[model samples]
Target chain A: MSFFNALLEHTFLQHALFGGLLASLACGVIGSFVVVRRIGYMAGGIAHAILGGMGIAYFLGQQPMSGALISALIAAVIISRVSRVSKHGHHQEDTIISALWAVGMSIGIIFIAKTPGYNVDLMSYLFGNVLMISANDLLLIGLLDGGVLLFTLIYFKQLLALCYDPEFAGLRGIRIEWLNTLLLCMVAITVVILIQIVGLILVIAMLTLPAATARLHATTMLGMMILATALGMMITSGGLLISYNYDLPTGATTALSSGILYLVAALIPQRRHAVK
Target chain B: MPALITLKDVSFSYDDRPILDHVNLTINEHDFLGIVGPNGGGKSTLLKLILGLLTPSTGEISVFGKHPNQVRTRLGYVPQFATFDSAFPITVLDTVLQGRLGKTRSLLGYNKHDHAIAQRAMAETDVESLQKRAMTALSGGQRQRVLIARALACEPEILLLDEPTANIDPHHGESIYELLHRLHERITMILISHDVGFVSRSVTRVACLNRTLVCHATSPVDSDSINHLYSNPVSVIHHDTRLSLEDNL
Candidate 1:
């Protein structure tokens, strides 16, 4: 009954709640594109690959978040290049990503091993600590949310054209390769930010589950994003509350909320698609 | 005046496999050119070249007397009907509205004028009523019409379609060609098709492509020319006649 009181009472809890909302907005907007583009596997690969960056950061006594972000970006580019830029093995994106995914994770483990005074808590990175969100982290999340919102706003139509009909978009003078690289970079940022909510292991689920559920009900990309955001907010905040009250993992609870909602959405046969 | 699109001694190859070998062609303003060839005879490849999707391995190609890249916005293209994924959640109107991306370059995307153009294009393609329909919910014929509506949304001077009639029922095929026939009076069109008999009646001129290309006024595309163009010494099945050009490969 005093849950609202506790939220007001605890600053960390307040930060966690606010952090949940920011994650929801970014994930909801970014997740729709990831699911629709069929790049969920790539997102997963990048998420795991971020471990390499975090390890390198620890070894160098640098900001682990920056390392993770840069590594994720590099992994995104390599995957895009292998799948697109390479002349012969264009279709072997999954193969290249799979190789990188393992290589990245192993490199991180080795780096962490080699570091003399490596006392960084791997558990927090492996399975996110939403409750441990700092003021700086919250600020960074807010900035990322702004950037993502601005990008979607400016490129909504072009992105729609690119996603729905790439060839036609290319014919219309849209630089397909450059735009693709930019989109992947945006996705990399999304992965970096979302790690706090769902950790590396569950980040893909965090990214896709709400968007997939929203896709069941919404017909337009805009509608999909809005509904997915609302769903993500409900799931993330709800999961945070449940986890706090019942002493469970915040990431699992948040992701489980989305998975449960998706099941329910799937069960309800989608309404007939009315023309817009 | 320069032709709307001109390919001067253009040749394209994949590895050692030749697609279009030393082909020269010209398309004038408001010309309806239907390109017909065997399955692997570079019919679609020619459209790709014109659309600037592919570069010639040898020689030069120009659209509107400039490089294809410079004239892309003025050219509307419909790739093969086989390439569309109907499972997408986009609406017919939204799909058609994509054609206006070239023009609607503002913070507030697709103003009233853009919407009006899309509506007119949909009307032109006879998909006005179905604009609100989900793209996946539409029939094959309806989807082709929507695609044409999208291409028309560009208000293009030259329209190129890879294969609009493939995988469509004959009744729908005829209707699609009829619609194209109506549109080509204002827009120069190049349609690629392997079925010579079905598409020959619609185009004013026909281009026969193997590794080499041959142009014939629509009335005189006899089996002698067909035998000469195709590798097999065989006959062609037209709108009436049933014959097979035996495969040499």
Candidate 2:
């Protein structure tokens, strides 16, 4: 009840609640693809790699989100290119992602340390503070959400085929390598949007949890996406209310909410749909 | 009859190791060719080369008088069952609908024509009844039929199946072969398999690959030659008398 009253009284609280909804849009859509393709680790690596971009932007007195967007796109391209060129396969790709993951963190730490003045927002950036999201951040999140949704609508079939059986897609005249790279680019953008809501640390959790939970019940890909979005909304709003009432960190609370739901869904014994 | 596909002196190597060496073969229109070989004998490599998924290091190949890549849409492919993700959240209808991907151009989604074609393909493959079922819920035999339906939805001139029955029991495997036989009248087929007996019994022609290829009619294939080709004892069963061949390895 107090949380509802605070939502009515505070503009920042409204923005946080609105921001969670917008972030959930991209998370439900792109996150479904990430989970189905089993690329959550790659998304996590992309998420962590954004710190380098944010730190550089802060050091240069520029908006950190812009730097994040640039670095995420660059990291996605580099990772996909390495994956395409490596003859040895996914092991090499995994190694490259780990390297970028650590390197990005170290680079960010050095840049932030060198920046002048007390950088109090560092923890907020690392862990995220949805309450601190400004009007401009809300607008940015909306635009990115639109971009993610549009891309998905336009390339739905191609993306579906790519995820299901890439070799077959290639035979059918889909340029799978380019399509795969474009998908990674989408993942990169999605990571940046999620970063604004959950920060780098919990971005993958937000990206994967709702979609994974939805997978248990969805019968189709589109069904999965829609159900995941609804699930995301529930999880995000539930987390926001809990955090507001208890005075806890909003992002971590939201991620925690999603994780608990996913575990609960998994524990329920589903009738074996698969044949032996 | 003119050849539907022609390969002249094709050789493919991976990282300086040869997989296929100087293989020349011709596939006529309506030919049901079964490819048999030991594991790592380049049988699958030959199929990949023909499908334009891999390039031959030194050879010239042509499909319908053009390059394989140029005519990819006209060739339907059913990959190995082991290669698929059955747990994916897709229905049988949607899986078959992917076969019409080449013809589906609208951004709105698959058109009415696409759905009709997919439906017909499903009916032909006997998976129309299971169109709404989740892919994960289907048995291995059912999944294989769905994959074949997906390929058939392409309305392809030639169908390529890579070990479609590799994971199924002999009962299901025979049923899959029967399904393929029924479709043979309208579409050319190239099948890869380890069951020498079935290949000899089913296909119009058999190609034995052991880093190279030996083309033979079904009637003259003997166990001694096949066992020597595999460098071990191999069982050769005869299921019919229509196709008969025997030779020295």
* TM-scores, each model vs. reference: 0.92, 0.96
Q: Candidate 2 residues A1-276, lDDT tens each?
A: 688898999999999889999988999999999999999998988988899998999899998999999999999998888888775443587889999999998888889989999875788888888888899999999999999899999889989999999888888888998988999999999899888788899998999999999999887999999999999999989999998889888889999999999999989877644333
What CAPRI-style quality would you assign to candidate 2?
A: medium
**What is the per-residue lDDT of model 1 for residues A104-154, given as tens digits with 9 covering 90 to 100?**
888888888788964767878888999999999999999988998899888
- What are the per-residue Cα lDDT tens digits for candidate 1 across B25-140? 99987789988888888888888888788898998999888999888999888876567556676899999988988777556578888899999998888889988777767778
User: Using lDDT as the measure, which candidate wins?
Assistant: 2
Q: Candidate 1 chain B: minimum summed lDDT over ten consecutive residues — where?
A: B240-249
Candidate 1 CAPRI classification by DockQ: acceptable
Query: Whole-model Cα lDDT per candidate?
Result: 0.85, 0.89
Model 2 is docked with a DockQ of: 0.66
lDDT score at residue A6, model 1, on the 0-100 scale: 91
Q: Residue A258 CA error for candidate 2 (Å)?
A: 1.3
Off by over 4 Å in 1: A1-5, A87-91, A116-118, A272-276, B227-249
**iRMS values in order, in angstroms?**
3.3, 1.8
